[model samples]
Target: MYRIPFDRVNWTTSSFLIGTALIALFGLPVYLYHYGANWFLVALFFFYLIATMMSITVGYHRLFSHLAFKAKLPVRVFTLIFGACAFENACLDWASDHRRHHKHVDHDGDPYDISKGFMWAHIGWLMFKLNPEPPMDNVNDLRKDKWVMWQYRYVHWIGLVVGLIIPSALGYAWNAYHGLDPWIGALGGFLIPGIARIVVAQHCTFFINSLCHTVGRQPYSTSHSARDSAVMAFLTFGEGYHNYHHEFQHDYRNGVKAWQWDPSKWTIWTLSKLGLADSLRRVPDSKILLAEMREARRKAELHLEEIRQQQQPGQCQRASDKVHELVEKLAANYHELENAIAERVQLSREALNRWQNETRGIMREISRIQLLTPA
Candidate 1:
């Protein structure tokens, strides 16, 4: 069991996290029971939810942390404002920690290393301060941006004003305009959209650190604890594709598939169309396919070895021969495919297409080979 280092407790952070969560848990139901939810309150909750959640996923994680894309000033300012409202921290700090997490995943230097424990990755890291605070040297590029520096200087105040005050103000004003008791709306706003929304957004982001690492499939890479979860993607605005993100950190799209539900990716694409974002980085499909094929090949080799170990020499000779045949072919095709992708820049379009098709065929063969192996 992990022991709390009371001496090193981050009182402010702990208080805020615990306080907001308690209120959201108990206070929200009570408020609903008394005043009941109105369309204005529901709209307010969703509005804050989308704005703040997108700010963290699209703005903080992708744009700022990975430099996946560049955005215009208005976009930057808007994210900074609402991102502050999410109350995670300034972009520089959040990005610095995130970069470090990727660099030192599941290791000593990772801030929220899941290897430490699920709770630690989720929120314990924040409530209990590390003896030595992480240095800020990693974010020199962000420091050069005046807007980021400005937000860093006053993140708490910005959050209070925009995240809480504005929502309450809007609720009160709307009720007043409708000739209702404005105080009720103001209270509802502060509790539901203001406080409750913060808790929801925060936990969703935290889920990326905890649940994403814990309960998902690592299809892209098993080098780290990161995994992909469609459920988490829905909750985290598409950040649930953790394995892909870890393997291809600089790619702007987390859910790389055409049918994947990555609202953050879509939002960035939309911003680019509106001329608000540009220079979106993407991993080459060939490279992504290569990663998948390599992992599959590794698994197949293990399965072959396991089969050999389970059976006596010359037993199941046909199965052994078939496995050897598939494995050899896969390796040869993998080598040729690697060369093709590496020389893709020099290859004509038709030639590249042929190589891609060959790679896809090898992928299908790998899948079928898995079924041939004994359960």
Candidate 2:
């Protein structure tokens, strides 16, 4: 692959510099002082942090980007507006970059490929000009939607105004109205929760593109750098299961298991039940189990090959026997599970289709009855 000349790239932007400087100077000091030097600020900061993080996870990632689930227009609009507060980017832009990353993962074209280097993958790439021309290909689908286009066009300004400026103004108003010192609210609301939250939120999201690919367990597939890290999930509101996400990008849920720590998935699921969202995508259990089985078998085969190459006859024999036993047990379990899951998925799909047809019929009948009665 041909490399773009570094000298040809424009490496600085006024907005990026201002944003970086504010975070480093004002945001960092406020966070350290409040979190360590003041307890009350810490509590306030954390509360806002959690809420904003969910806006990105539940709103940006699962809902907007992947369309893994369908949300009501009102709910969808709310998410898009608040999601901008994270100051990451517009949902359309963010989603476009993500889709491109998945499409060209591990290749030079992948926007955040860890193979490029940890820093580069995490946030360095943003420092350089990204094709200067608009990303028409990645976001063509979004352009047709006026709301998404509007957000994409003005996300940066909206984020700055609402996420930063408005909060500061509100802080001043409260101080004037209540006769409390405005500095306290300004520092607490604007600096600590607002600016500081952006820094932390951005890093937490970036870590999935960097740290997640660099560390954690790869029980599912070793073909990619993605990994499943519980710690990362906790920090990023359930985005830590990178391996599963990369493997099943279309699935709405990252942590497939009931016990998995995926607050984002839980939020979406609860909202779906309340009719705020619908069409939650999920990978079949059979497919996930089969993938796991295949990986395990691959590992066992490699281990056996190593033992055989070492010329340790007894060890090889014992290892071979163990592998054979394990494989047989796993195969039996896989087949049983697969058969049951396949049947369940088929039945579920049929039931859902029938329900949709019946509901439509009932609605049509009601309309006909009203027409026959005359106004």
Best by TM-score: 1
Candidate No. with top lDDT: 1
Q: Tell me the TM-score of each prediction against the true structure.
A: 0.93, 0.79
Q: Which residues of candidate 1, in runs, are more than 4 Å off?
A: 345-375
Candidate 1, position 246, lDDT: 97
- lDDT, candidate 2, at 1: 100
Candidate 2 backbone overlaps, count: 0
**lDDT digits (tens) for residues 94-115 of candidate 2:** 8888887888888866888789
Q: What is each predicted model's overall lDDT from 0 to 1? A: 0.88, 0.72
